[model samples]
Target: MARRGQRQSGATRPAPQRRRPARDADGLLPVLARAVREVESAVERSDVRPSVRTKFQVVALLVREERSRVNADHTSSDAYRAEQLRRLDGIATILAKSAARETTLLGLLAEDAVISEAAASLKREMLIAAGQEPPREEPVSRPTTPADTTVRRVVPQTVVQRQLANPFLAPDFSSAPARPPRPGRLAGWELITPLLRSFEHAAASASKALPEPTTLRTAEGLELMPHQARLIASAAAGHRTFLLADEPGLGKTAQALLAARAVGAYPLLVVVPNVVKTNWAREAGLWTPKRNATVIHGDGETVDGFADIVIVNYEVLDRHVGWLGDLGFRGMVVDEAHFIKNKKSQRSRNVLQLSERIRTRAGRPLLMALTGTPLINDIEDFTAIWEFLGWIDETGPRAELMESLEETDLTPADPGFSAAARARVIDMGIVRRRKVDVAADIPARRIADLPVELDGAIGRSIRDAERELADRLVARYETALATRTSGSTVDGIDHDLVRRVAGWERSDRDSAKTGENVFSLVRRIGRAKAGLAADYAAQLAHSVGKVVFFARHIEVLDAAEELFTERGIRFSSIRGDQSRTTRQKNIDAFVNDPDVSIAVCSLLTAGVGLNLQVASNVVLAELSWTNAEQTQAIDRVHRIGQAEPVTAWRIIAAQTIDTKIADLIDAKAGLAATALDGSDDEVAASADFQLEALVALLTNALSE
Candidate 1:
């Protein structure tokens, strides 16, 4: 064999070939593959705090680099380029899967996601892991000359005075200890969802038992209810934080003002909805006569810096947030606290940030989030409320709550954790009481939906518009099916597909100017029913001492006011366009003036904060999109001071989307019941009335 081994060696030596190590058959770069694996592993582990943010940044950076390389490579054939792109897409798919595991991570994938310093650092670490040199950090250039900008807000003199009075305001940490770190059993696991789940499963029993009142202290002539007195007792016993979710008519206003009085939480800050700013001051006077309460108007020209109680509305909170933070308030009460449920809104941000500053400055400060209808859509609506109460922070439970969760010896994954978590949170100051529970303390309230038939051309036009809209939606759904690659046949109609089509139609309605949308159609129905609703309200005002007529549109209000004027019925107008003084004057005319038989109010402006309990009967001229709005309107008359049973008449247009919307509002009310009132009813996941109305219309059209 020609010296067997020697011959073979000579043949190989001809080229002096070098053997390369095995690589992925897919041809993924070694560095990129390593980075992908590392990131995937970190994101897959729930206990590792899931490096979701880092993973998103690394994958995003890789995608950008890979796209650039693919674009610049002209040597490669289109097929080869497509294959590279597909491979990169596979990496992106993994990153998406990782994000799907943590709901909070989804926001990072948004098109406008900002690359923070931490994200940039993580990108470099990922690049280094991929055996590639990270890009050099570019030096941030300083401007040669500072740009001049006008100052938007000047520090108020009251703020300066307050600061001068308490120059050494320091954060009190005595209530929250830093030592002996207490990591809970659920410390590593996300517990917010489970904590909320507990509320969902809570029984619809009456209010939970409260501590016995040690001493019943009533404000001069103000007689406290048994439940109200009990809360005052708890405050006197040193309970600092409370989420007073008692139903609307249970005297939350009185309770909040008096509770502050009991704890000596003077120089208290009460943040309320604009509609209730005046009401808060009035209630403060009634409940705590000794404490001087001042309401802050625009620019706060009339605000008393040294008043015992300072009341400000949410609308002007932004302008006042800076000074309010430096005002050294010992207690804070946020009325209609559900306004801050959207944690991302500027209003919510200002409220939560100001609350945080107050908590930091006065560790033992009394914080209360008072909302009769707290659970608007979801149980997690409690997030901002809990934050306002200082029981939890942005990261997770605060030290005291963490300690409580730790003592439970269970994680969210455990079976018994939910109840334990609920008990723990409830013990930390969640007070939920329904009108049914305290029925004796307050009058019963009923919502009566009055369906009216629309006749003639306008009515027919409305019906035709609704049918046309539904037909359009159905056409879209069919088109989507025809284009689907899979020839899959669905039974009846694919509800999910139907919902998707409805959602598209609904969104299109917002921007589309040529077509009649659900919103416009509802408005049309309101217009058609305006005369009838006004006639009924005029009749009600005569039968029932006073009637509060509420409507969503100014046109409807104008029509009702015109009818009232023609009928010789004295009426007062409360609309958003009116100045605060005008609004107050109109409100007073209805409340204190016997000649003012009706208060024609904007459902949005006069709904939440005004105490129209003076009128036991309310006429809702048009339906609202949400049950909360409707409840707020009805509650304006069904509050604590009302001596008679309250009835709300909701005018619904028959044989139209208005009836369906009225039903949807009633259905949506179940969300609050299941969440706050502890009803076991199954809550519809989506409380979006407009979407539901579109779905109903499409379903009906498709069926026909």
Candidate 2:
């Protein structure tokens, strides 16, 4: 009897009965419908001027609408419910514009705002549909439909009235002449005095704790060796702070850490090149006292917790400035400060900016830059680096020192310009220590300049290229100058015209221009570089010890590799493409293994922070503009740990642009000390771009 209706219903009904669909208290369909309506209304009102209240109202209403719809249905579809909630979230994000005032909210709004708005809109819609108008709005304000109430949170018309002034943005009510900018030392006395006092206290404690130096002094507690202690003490006391420019294997990192610690500067920040970040961290743990030192990089925890020492690589420092500002870092150790010599580089600019912002509860923080080659073979390199370390002298010996160096000679008992410059610069607190001068265990360096003449055939070809290149360069220069000088009434000449002008120029060199016929000159230089590499390969074959060759051109690198390969010379190259891990591995094999004879590298990749004491020979296939660059390459073998004499051979193509460049580099190297001493004037006069030198080489070759 019971089965009779069931069988009939099965036959007549919509198919056989399947499982009943699941339902929420509020059906998914209603919530989704409500969410869609709110989105539509918000989009229509999107033209309203953006404000915090308007943004908040928009988001809140959307979320409330979603919640109401979800809560109302006894039966709902899962897909419909999920979609409605997602839509409600999106609505909340539009409303979040109200919460963002000072900080950028683009990412936060994109990620989280939408979800919140959807929920609110859904709830608001459901309530309105149930004949429950929210308390805040009057009867007239009530929404026409349940979905309209979902949009009630956002009141576009009353946005201005709802907005409130943030206290942080309020103007300071009290003013007392705003303390007119103070004078030197005194101008910052209020800030500097306390910091100096704190530094003094740290210095005293370090001295008291340090044990007396003896032959076995290094055996004592975590204290520095006597010589190292002296360097640290000097660096810690200076106003200009110190540039610990010690060669590799001389423990530059150790010296910097000890200097900071001796001054009771616990919250010290160290910035190094990317490759050395891990080394610095590990070194800190082994050498420094038991304290929290965090390395900020890749998957590392956010430095929310306090740390005694914070080590970061140059690549990552720009991203974590806020953390640094909050820490009130009292001391900064720029381990490879040379990385910032280019003012345009982010690390250099960022560190300089940080120097401007670093203020403790006590005063402005101290800066310490550590690099072996402060001058890097160029006088301007010193200027670039010294300015970064706060070594400016407006009226003192540093300024007068620059004036004296311009004359280029010295008289008896005059305490020459270089001396005065050193005193003034040193007074500001930039200390430069040389391993050869101070550390005796370090081996002596033997350097030689090898000048070679190209064969007549190649030389003549190179000369022809130079003439063609120079003509084009001059024409290009004149055209550019002409266009720049032309009044705005006339449209400027195009690059093609400039090239034509350069091609037509009669002179082989242009004094006013930096580069000449780039295409021809590049080709000429390329040939010369190849010829020089062949010459270097011939010379290196005779060398006994393992040799490290630093090349500036990839052409030279390839040419040299060919020579090595053809001659069966076992060699390894560490160039830019190799990962840091691979680079280190290759360098280690070259330095440590007797079977491997040579390590070829690019000047840029192996320029700094490398230890190559195992080899006694360094060869530069081409010259760089900066002396420090050459010195760093040379120092790879000449560093403190080398036991044998370090020999450096620079292969120069005589009477070419190579020779001219080498001459300028040599001239600049002589002025590096004075320049570093904070005197730039005389240093500027000694070095000049000599287009005539290039022309003479060209003319001589043409005559040949």
Candidate 3:
């Protein structure tokens, strides 16, 4: 039964048949073979123009399409099929080499990269030249939104009065940036994608080259830490924009307010989270007393029309975005800038629009996007942050960045372009300093996870809720897969679609309200873990003298306080709703009063402004959505004046969503570590982590 090409023996068979290179006489193979060679030569010569990149992508796409066609052709003989695949592999090898030579071309090979019309048109021509009609191409539809996507927008009467009072303060286009008369060297090479990927492979120190510290410039007896002073000096030296991403508890608020003062960015506008809105005014007075500060509350009825610094929270920003944009504020600061990572969200749009207005109005405003979490989820997080700082825009690098790349004297086709590009971007005022970088100025801190298994009925409910959420996610995923019209079926789990479905569940108000969501599930987990966290806190209180317990929900706080009372332990309660005096009084009691062993604090309120270095031991009853939040809570005790090394006891529920979120946060922490600390760990995935808990864990354990 042996075939003509093979002969069988008792112990041995004829040598396996060799796969000869198939002739490219009659198919798309000839066109792709020629195209790949062209691409290779173009890249080798450092002439990888946009058209050349398009050809490379087309050749790669056609090779894959033809290989699939050859393997699935029932009429073709097996020998012919094998030879065809071998030839296709040869073409693929050339494409790989070209990508290696011009690394920026590698982005076009990614699965998520959209196929441009040029590439599609090129593919059609190649297939037509092979005497076959090409199929019609359908455009990929992304989630779209309206221009004014926010639910509502309003201008307060006081804002209108302020604007009327300053009628001469019309927008000053004289200072707006003019477009370059001619295109730069690397004009149309899709530099944004390459620039973003630059960070993923980054190893250089994250911060910009800062000037040495100047003398402390505060009006009061307040003094700046050395690292803080260096950044202020950079601003004083006329650096306009900064992605000031020092780790939490590094006093970013002080730096920002003082930076505005250094530049005399009067009529400064600061957009921050609601929890820290009041603290901005307080810190402004403390750091730069010469500058008057006012916080805009509901409708901004009491907002000082002529204050030197105007502060507004993100929640009410929608109402004020109108007038804020109209006002000619010389400087703008977005605190917790990560909140605007999702560019489609109303808040993100508002922030971007205001930044644009500021750029247009002021010649060169002092724009600072302050966030300790350099990346909350993924490398793409840099897009919005960069746009807010006027580095890059929707299409590609704006004028300033384009000019920097031009000075590199290397195209995307040239060797070492990515690194050079990253360095240029860093030079554009990415001031990242970790606490470890200033460890001499501050004590060392560590976060340790304590896995606690939930065994009782409460645990059962949490597990059940978690299962329900997972099932819903899976069902949605399957439905999406089945209904997908685009014939692009992936081999395994489509993590992109899973992320999309999870985002829909989280953002779609109707669906999120109807079913059990991640928020409810997390709250349930926190409620269930209250007693266990309290017990651990009680133990720590006895051992370490004073322990700070942080919880997100009031019910969890009440339960912890009840447990402490049953054990007859004295504790102080601090909450978001508490008045300033009351909150401070409780904090004073916990700090000065030795008998108060634990301070039951709200993670949202007490996490930011309070100085609880009196306690070295801290217990977390609930997990936060972002690493920065968790770090903020722990940093309440990890700041200056800590006598010993700090430890954060993260009470993670084993085999639950709690553990997944913990790992995700840990992965995101690598962004700051690598970008800021210049450590070995690479940056993690996008912040849109929801259903890929298992995927995250595996990626964390394995190399990319």
Per-model TM-score, in order, reads 0.47, 0.36, 0.47
| Candidate 1: regions farther than 4 A off | 1-151, 169-181, 205-208, 215-219, 374-377, 443-704
* lDDT of prediction 3: 0.76
Sort every candidate by lDDT, greatest first.
3, 1, 2
lDDT score at residue 155, model 1, on the 0-100 scale: 59
Candidate 3 error regions (>4 Å):
1-152, 172-176, 375-377, 443-554, 557-704
Give the per-residue lDDT of model 1 (tens digit) for 1-704.
Answer: 23422322433244236232233443335555566666667655542232445555556666877778898999999998998888787777666555434333444454334455445545544554454444556222221211111011335667667778878876666676334436545657776777777888566432335788754557475566678888888888888888887755567888888889888887899988553565577677777888899877656766777789998876566557878887778899998787687676556778888888887777789998887663423678789889888888777888778888899888887888877888888888878775556667654887766556564578789989888777778789899988988878898978888899888888783535767888888888889889879967875664445889999998899989877875679999988889989989888999999989999999988887798777877888899988989988988887887776677877778779987898888878866776778766555568788899989888888888
Query: Which candidate has the top score in TM-score?
Result: 3
Top-down TM-score ranking: 3, 1, 2
Give the CA lDDT, 0 to 100, for residue 387 in model 2: 53
Model 1 residue 179 distance off true place after TM-score fit, in angstroms: 5.3
Query: Candidate 2, 228: how far from true, in Å?
Result: 1.4
lDDT of model 1 at residue 504?
88
Query: Which residue window of length 10 is worst by lDDT in model 2?
Result: 201-210
